[model samples]
Structure formats: structure tokens, C-alpha cells
Target: MFPLVMIASLVALGLLVVYYVGGYLFQNRSLSDIPAASPWAALTRFWLVREARFGRRYLTVDDAHKTHGDFVRIQPNHVSIANVNAINAIYGHGNGFLKSDFYDAFVAVSRGLFSTRSRADHTRKRKIVAHTFSAKSVMQFEQYMHQNLNELLRQWDLICQKAPANSKFARFDCLPWFAYLTFDTIGDLAFGSPFGMLKNGQDTIEYMDYPGGPSKYMHAVDALSRRGEAFAVLGCLPFLKKIGHLLPDSFLRNGVRSGSQVAGIAIARVGERLASTATKGTERVDILTRLMEGKDVKGQPLGREELTAEALTQLIAGSDTTSNTLTGIFYWLLKSPGVLAKLQAEVDTVILSPTDEVAFQTVKNLPYLKACMNEGMRIHSTSALGLPRVVPIDGPAIEICGRTFEPGTVLSVPNYTIHRLESIWGADSDQYRPERWESLTDDQKKAFVPFGHGPRSCVGRNVAEMEVTLAMATLVRRYDFELYQERFETWEGFLRKGFCCEVGIRRRMT
Candidate 1:
């Protein structure tokens, strides 16, 4: 009798879930006209969750655009727009498209600029740190950049030194090397100290249980990647977070742990900086120093919690995005030897010698080098996935690219899809040809949004440009690479990241 009752209860629960989900999908009357990516997309959120969990969310959505055209219903309420013209209506300033609830998963100590939804709040936050990312301010960070790059070159030099007696090349993975470079550079710039990742050749870093508490080490890059993928999956269906501990999926489970670890790491860094500031009675010229002194709209200095949150944002944003771009550029360069030669020629003109520090002013305006970087960004988009924005339910009707989107509809322009559109980029849109960027059409310019479109675009754009160009120039001027793998594979989670770019690198003959 007990077993029969249990079976009946289970059946009832299943029926209730089905009924609820069915109603939830069909209840959104405004979304009826938008074409669903698939029947599964229309029926359940499972398909979306699966794609996000397994790290193909961006690709899957891009494929949907190929089949369904510009507007695709990736989720019951979410529409993915692939049209370039829709950019202004959707993401332009004062468009009333607040960041969707999808960003709630990315919240660390508090809502940093990237995760903040409120327009006024985003404005206030941007005001606090925007100057630090400006062109001039970012140039000030080049000293730290050069230091970290030198450390990276030291490690790579040792690897090359170990090459066989006859061979000029030594096998090394460029992706992790780039990761180390970016992480250390950002660490020094943000915290007034480096993570020592480049020197150590490992991702392990120390964190604390709390401020001034016992410290322990964790693999930060792995934690960050796992948390990013996991949070992306869970963010789609936020309810899963509550029962995350009970879930069978280890990735999701580990992501929850990683999130805590990341938070703790941020807290620990902020705490150390505060302690240092108090005891030393002097401040280093770093992002944290500016944050420590920054006043909010109310004229109050940001609290420790806010400072830690911003620090966490900087670590995640400042490192991975630029590193991924660097990796992408290297992958493309190695694949196209002719292009690489051309870029090297341009770089050599400016960089002069292997030991010469690549300055921002020297490399910033090089046309071919700029073209190569632009091409790399276009081909291998870091933030491949669409950043979802909500059409405010209370706002006036907004028309985007000849179609009126109902209020409360979630919308996004998938960067991966728009970038690869044959209409804008011509027939060879899929290729990694730097020459294409040398003569881009007006449509191509509109379609290119690796940083993103409108006011909410990446605030750290200047810093990213300085980091990438300087690093790439230094690399091309110093080494010649032979790729180990035939294909450069990438996966899309929080950002599109390469698995690895294994190469046989040797000192440049020049």
C-alpha cells in the first residue's frame, strides 16, 4: 500500500509539472509570432539549458538563425535578433532595454557594472570607474603590461631553450601562456600585486575563508571557466540555483562551489589591499587605488563589499576576454602563414628588437597589425553569445528593424551570428583573412560588434585594445610559430574560449 501511494504521488507531481510548463509556454501571448528555434525550444527550457550547460549555446543559437532567419525564439520569452539595424533600437542609449534576469547568475559580492540592470545604477557605476579605462588611463597600465609580458617571454624562452640540438622550435601551448600573461597583467593593474601565474606556469592562486581569515589555494582559471559555464546554464532557469546542491550534474554542482571560491578570492584580494593601504600609508597607482578613492553619486566612498565586487568583475572581465582575443589572434596567425608574415613585417617595423617593449603608441596605429587584430576578433568572437536585454513591460512600444517587439520580451543580437552573416561580410565571411578588414563596407562596420553595441558595451574597451595590440606586436616581433593541431577548437560559455593553441615556437630570425 505504501509503494502504491508513492507511485501515485510521483505520477501526480509529473503531471503537475507538465501542466505548469505547458501553461507557462503558451501564456506569453506576445511571443506567438516569433519563430521558435525548434519544437523543443517552444515546448521546454531544457534544450536551452542543455546547450548552455554543455558549452554550445552560442553555436546552437547561430545555427537557429541560419534556419529561422533574423528573429529566433531561443527561449519561450527570449528572441535572438541577428539584424545589424536592430542594434540601436535594442541596445542604444535610453532604449529602455534593461539587462535581463539572465545576469543575476553573474552577480558576485554585488552588482558590478556588467551585471547591473538599473539604468541609473549602471550610470553611477560607470561614472565611478570609466575614467580608469579611458585611453590615457589605460596607457598608464602599460608599465605593468610590459612587466607581465617580460615574465611570459622569460618562461617561453626557457621552453625554447630546451629544444632538441637540431630543432629551433619547442612545443608549448599558447592559450594558457596568453591566459597567464593577461591574468598577471590585470592582477598587477587591479590589485597592486601580480598573481605570479606567468612565473609559476600554473593557475593556482590563494584565497581566504573571509577577510583576514585562513588562506588556501585554488585553480582560478579552471574555477572561473567552470563557474562561467555553470552560471550561464543555471542563469537561464534561476530556480535550479536553489536546488543546485541536490542536482546530479557535477559541473553545475562544482560551479556553485567555484562561485563561492571566486567570491572568496575577490574578498581576500580586497582585504589585503585595504590592510596594505592602512599600514603602508601609501597607495600604488592601480585600479584598486582609484576605486578606493572613488566617490559615489551620494559623495560617499564605495564600501568594502562594493570594492570587492568591482574587483571580482575586473578579474573576470579584464583577464579572460583579452586573453581569449590574444589566443584567437595567435591561432589565426599560425594558420595563415602569409598573413602572419605580413603582420610580422608590420610588427618588426615598430617593435625593432626581441627585447624591445611594444609600446601602445608604436603599435596602436599600425594598419596591417590593426587589420589582423580586427580579423581575429571577427573570426573568433569572445562573447559569442547574445547578451539578453529585456523590453521593459511598462515602457512604450519599441520597433526594431521593422518589427514591433512586445513589452516584456527578452531580446538580443547574437554577435556570433551577425558577424558571420554573408550579406554583410561577403561570401568569404567564414575565412580568417586580415585583408578583408582593410576594405570593410559600411554594413560590415555596423555588423562588427566584438565589444558590443551602444552605451552598455564593454567599458574596458581601451584597456583591452592596448593589451591585445601590444602583446601581439611583441609576440610577432619575437617568435615564429608552427601549430601542433590542424584545427583550433573553441567552446562558448560565458565567453567563447579556445581549448588550446599548441605550437612549436622558435625565436624569430629577424
Candidate 2:
């Protein structure tokens, strides 16, 4: 009886192993059963190792799209679609896809607005803050924006003046300046207190410190995010969570502590704002106030935890993305002198005086400047990496270029690859030509998705654009700048961090 029982147990264990392995292999099945080209074969084990060790060659992904046409499986269970039609199908409203576990890394504080994976949950969270980003709410914050821009311009003027007469040609990267302006603006708007980045010329956020500067934190977060992806992959194992606890406490502690600090700050700020109804007039009308006053579809007020998560999410989303986009714009403009001149001409023509506070209406009329901003966003999208989404159960099987993706298949459309595709944008697609935007028809414009498409598109996109336009206009109109470093290299360690362009600046003679 004992021998028979041992043999049965061994047989059961063997079957279990076979079952799991078969499922694993089947889950990662090739997408080539349909008519799509097998372009991913080129990116074999050797190539992946090289690509992983070195940084992501976004240019290489662009090249792959050219060779493979619209749809190509770039990795095992991962595919890239360059077709414009696919964008709507992949990320459009009611697309029936939820963000994949790849986004789980961003869940720093218990599933905030950005970290929520469920379509229903996202809709609920979005509704709570939808009014805050409406046209009316943004206009209300115009004064706050103007004040921040003025602060930035004042600082730049001082910096330009301080350069020694002999060394007046001193060069410094405009990236840091843009970073300070973006973070400071978001800091004030979100937390009601500036990180004092613009005033101090450094990131003095109590918990987080951008050692090499604000840009360095971008790099660190990118690296850490990649590590988090590895953890998620490992999490598939049954006992991995238990093993995770055995890993270094510091790794888990830092993330938890940082999240707690951010949440604490946001909670405290909201409490303070709510406490002082005396000063809660138009001046206190930031995103926080809007959120505090908001109620869900069922007329339930957002709870304290929900408010904290949402607020911190806004702070992160508003600050980093805007900073990255603005940095990219400055980087490109400084390199292309003619583009800079054209932008300056538009600003000068529209604003009449560069130093004067730019009203929303005046800034809106500068089509060329707007086009330039759009082009920069397209060329070097801050959200360059593919935002992964999982296929929903009971949804129509997604067919991309004759290839069928089953439910639960992880899918994405890499923006970096899509934006630079020759088939979509013509030969000079990779070049920074804002004029290309002018040539685009309405249909083509609809395909141009820097902030993504549909309801899930960036909530703060309008605010971000306004901030970038005002900052670029103010800087170009006030200064004549040259690239300190000629070559532009992007370090895509994780979230396209260390992506900067160094430049030299001198105040233009009035």
C-alpha cells in the first residue's frame, strides 16, 4: 500500500509539472499562425541580450516597422503595430482592454488613478477628477500658471545677467531650467507648496532628492521600474511573494516609504486647504480643491485614501511628463537654429513683448509655436515606451494586420516606433519639422497621438501644452542659445530618462 501511494504521488507531481510547462509555452505562442510576417525572429536570444545590456534602440524599432510593414511580433508574446488604424483599435474608448501587469510597477501607492488596471475603476476615478481638467477649470488656473512662468523668466534673466562679460558665451543645458519650472508649477498646483526648485535651483523635496539633478531622478525611476518588471515576471511563481520578503528589506522599504511620504504630504495639504475656509477663495482653486469638492457618479465624495492616491498620481503625472516633454522641446529647438528663430518670430509677433505675462488667448494664437510643441512631442514622446494592455474576456478577438490576438494576450503600440514610421509620416518622419504638422490633414492629425487617444488620454494634456508653450515662448524670446553639446543621445534605461540636450545661452539684446 505504501509503495502504491508513493508511485501515485510521483505520477501526480509529473503531471502537474507538464501541465504548467505546457501552459507557459502555449501562453507565449507565436502570433504567426495568422498572416503577419515573422520579423521578431531577427531579434533572437543574442540580439535580446545585446539590446537589454545596451539601451533600447528606438531607431531599430523604427527600422523594424519599415521592414515588417504594419504588424510584427517584436518579442515572445509582444507585438508592435505601426498602422494608424490600429491605434484606435488598441487604445480607443470602449476598446475593452485594461492596462497590463507591466503597469503594476507604477502602483507605488495602492492603485491610484494611473495605476488602476480595471476599466471600470479607471472610469470611476477619472469621473471624480474630470471636472478639474475641463476647459473651465484650466482657465481658472491661468493666473497660477502665469505667476509660475513669471517666476521662471525672472530666474533666467538673473542667470543670464550673472554670466561674466568675458565668459558671456557660457553654456548650460536648458533641460534643468525646464525641469525646475515644470516641477515647481506642478508642485504649487498639486500640493499648494513649491518644492522651491525654481528659487533654490535644486530639487529639495523632503523625501526625494534628484542627486545629479531632477533629470537624474528620471533615470533612477526608469531603472527601478525595469527592476519592478523583473519582479512582476517572477511573481508568476506560486511562492515568489514569500521569497520576495526574504529579499533585501531596503528595496521594499524605499518604495513603501517614498509612497507613504508622498501620500502623507498630499493628505496633509488637502486637510490644510479644507481647514482654512477663510483663504479658500479663487486663489485656492487648484486641482486639490477641485478634487476635494468633487463627487462620484453615485454622489459619493472621494474618501481620504482615494483623495491621497489621486492627488499624488496627479503630482507625478503632471510634473514628470510635462518636464520630460518640455526638456525634449528645448533640446530640439536649441539644436535647430532656424526652428528656434521661427518659434521666436511667432512668439515675438504674437506677444509683442517677451517679458510681459502671456495671456492664454495670446499664447493660443501662435500656431507655429503650437506646431513646434506638437512636433517635439511626436519626435521624442515622453511616454515613448508601449503602454501595455491586456485583452478583455468576452471582447472581440483583436485582429492586427491579419493576426489574431487572443483574450489575455499582452499588447501595445510603441509610440516611438509609430511616430517615426516612414509609411505614416513620410521620409522625413524622424526629422524635427513642425511644417509637417501643417501638411497633415484632419484625418492624419487624428492619428497623431502624443498624449494618447480616447478617454484614457492624458488628463493634464491641455495644461501641459499651455505650460510648455509659455515656457518655450518666454525662453526663446528672451535668449539666444546655442547647443553646448552637438550630439543628441537618449538614454532609455527605463522610462526614457537621462534624455537631455546641453546648450549655452546669452540674453538677446532688446
Q: What is the TM-score of each predicted model, taking all chains together?
A: 0.95, 0.82
Worst 10 residues of 1 by lDDT: 19-28
Candidate 1 TM-score, true structure as reference: 0.95
Query: Backbone clashes per model, in order?
Result: 0, 1
Residue-wise lDDT of candidate 1 within 1-510, one digit each (tens)?
569989998998798678647745666567777888887786667778989988889888989889889899888778899998987778887777899988887887788888888888888888887867766667788899889989988998889888888887998788888888888988999988889999899999988767888999899888888888888898887768777777899989999888889888888889988887888865467788877778778887778888898888888888988999899888888898698888888888767787787788888999998999998999898888888999988987678877787788789999888889998888998999888877878889888898888888888888888889888888888888888898889877788888999999888756
Off by over 4 Å in 1: 1-26
- Candidate 2 per-residue C-alpha lDDT over 223-275 given as tens digits, one digit per residue, 9 for 90 to 100: 33344333333222223333444535454434333444444445555555555
Give the lDDT of residue 356 in candidate 1. 80
Q: How many pairs of residues collide in model 1?
A: 0
- Cα displacement (angstroms), candidate 1, residue 399, comes to 1.5
How close is each model in CA RMSD to the real structure? 2.1, 6.1
For model 2, the run of ten residues with the poorest summed lDDT: 209-218
